[model samples]
Target: MPKPEPTELSRPYWDALREGHLVFQRCSCGNAWLPARRHCPHCLKPEPRWERSSGKATLVSWVVYHTAYHPAFESRLPYNVALVQLAEGPRLLTNIVDANEALVADAPVELQIEWEGDTALARFRLAHVTV
Candidate 1:
């Protein structure tokens, strides 16, 4: 798997995930987003604070990939790339683990951090699934 190169602005987010927490930036004007940015996409306000997430989200949409565009992903063909809307209102592009063709939109999901080398990634699984 590939590793993420954290920039000065996004280091906090990556670090938090490494510590087992998901976070996003929110502006006082009531807008929230991910992939950390300098200002609110809604109000364009600077200094959006990093806030921890509840790790709860809903499957908004997704598509199953039948082909691997990257060499690193070749072994994981037929994977699902999903758009999950966080309970706190930010949407993230992530993968749905243990997913199949039976997956549907609006299904509730919870965060599950996985590691690749020393990097931590925020993945998700169906909330009601038993382990």
Candidate 2:
């Protein structure tokens, strides 16, 4: 399915996805931003530096969806959608691989970049956990 276009506020996020990195804006004023804002909410500074994320995250919650909100998603029904807590302290909403569902709840997952057309979005997969 064709991916949707990103707005100006979300361009950096899509760009970072294409580069195979999870980049978030961090201000020297001790602020970490999410949702790709134009400036730090606390200090109100523009052009914050892009920080490379560790790609490490833990699943916070998930639901096994059986419904499709769009026709493009009908084939992907029964998939698991989840919210993950990034190691960097941001919460990311993403999809979890089905093969890893047994380990999903509270399980660690790593960020993966998938390009659909010119746009790229970040996804997640099971993180190899060692006993």
After superposition, which runs of candidate 1 have C-alpha atoms over 4 Å from their true positions?
A: 129-131
Clashes of each: 0, 0
Clashing pairs in 2: none
Top-TM-score candidate index: 1
Task: Give TM per candidate.
Answer: 0.95, 0.83
lDDT (tens digit, per residue) of candidate 2 on 1-131:
75767898777777778778997778888677577777888889897777889999898998887888778889977777789888887777888764534754688889887765677777888888799
Give the CA lDDT, 0 to 100, for residue 61 in model 2.
91
Residue 65, model 1, lDDT = 88
> In candidate 1, how many Å is residue 114 off?
0.6
lDDT of 1 by residue, 1-131 (tens): 77789999999999999999999999999899998999999989999999999999999999998999999988988899999999999999999996577678899999999887899999989899566
- Local error of candidate 1 at residue 129 (angstroms): 7.8
